[model samples]
Target: MECKFLLDDFHVFAVDTIGHPGKSAEVCLSPNNYDYGIWVSDIITALGYDKMLCFGGSFGGGILSKTMCVSPEKIEKAVLLVPAGIKNAPAYKLLNMLFPMIMYWITKKETWLLKCILPMAISEKNIASDTYETAKCSIDHVKIKAGMPSDVNPEDMKNYKASTLVMAAEKDCLFPADLVLPQAKKIIADCTVYLITERGHMHYLTEAEKRMIVDFLHDN
Candidate 1:
């Protein structure tokens, strides 16, 4: 959604991840390894950019993390918001969402959908109109992806050279701040982190935070 800031400031390419639920090829790379990093590295090569400033959130954040490991030199900088791969909460933390999700799938009722997403969003008001629309469409038509990227290996991260900024949500049921930050700071040689206070996995960025992200990525 920060594409507007990126568009205003830099040359941008909005490449959809090849395996995701968008119009991309209907194939998902294994989330357990660095195959996605290899895929992204090839994209950078094909795009003729030796280095890139990257931004991604949630699942995209996981892919970016993989890219940082696969070819660190190719990334000029990075920003990951409410990201996966750095850390993910245990399955038990998410158990509350399962029944609502199943009911939504079976019944296609908006109430069940909202109930399912509220655990992630933290509040009914936190769900954006477009987010709601997108979720509804994706669930109605596409097979939902169940896996988030696995946490990155500290060893694989050792050679990462890009200055990285990770924006973690404090109360996110998945990838909570406590779980993500220590590893981010340890694995990245030049890492900066911002904790989004009182927020969960699906809250919107404040105007100030939006500017901060644009400035961080644009600085290099």
Candidate 2:
């Protein structure tokens, strides 16, 4: 698991939460209990980072939100993309809880499981060729070795206090904007929400968004 940021100027340290399938790098402060927010706090103190801005995408949003909740003093500002801590759909939660256990048992049947899991994380129509390939690579790794658990209770989100700029995809199927934005607004009254047109759950750094994010980090 790798948690690196593309920052040419200033220090940007990315923290990975548990059960992130190499996407999030899963580093926690308390290795025994693995409390996500406490781990984030530990990371800040351990790394000697202070009054920093944060940017989180997908499940990284969940971890960042938790990080703010646990250590609100550390975060100066935050930009969240497709944050995944809030559970709007009951059925999705059930499946997410079961995925790791089921994957462990069905080790040989990788393709079938991938088909089931991929659709949950992305819209069927927007599953780009490169995205599908990357997802398959990660899913294949999970099939071979069941990943860690990164699930967070909704209460943790309710406790966050960061002033956040949250963006959601209009056509996102994995983490719907309608559902997540409301939860974010509820969690932090200072949160601002934006719905991007025809985007997916993942927020990649194209030339424009990268510049926007860099400017945001610098200004904040």
Per-model TM-score versus the true fold: 0.96, 0.67
TM-score of 2: 0.67
Over 4 Å off, model 1: 1-3
Candidate 1's displacement at residue 86, Å, is 0.6
lDDT of 1 by residue, 11-88 (tens): 878888887767888788998899888988999999999988988788888988999999999999999888889988
Q: Candidate 1, clashing residue pairs?
A: none
Taking all chains together, the TM-score of candidate 1 against the true structure is: 0.96
Error of 1 at 189 (Å): 0.6
Error of 2 at 37 (Å): 0.5
RMSD of each: 1.3, 5.4
Clashing pairs in 2: 17-26, 19-148, 29-39
Each prediction's whole-model lDDT (CA): 0.87, 0.60
Q: Model 2: runs farther than 4 Å from truth?
A: 1-5, 16-34, 93-134, 143-161, 203-207
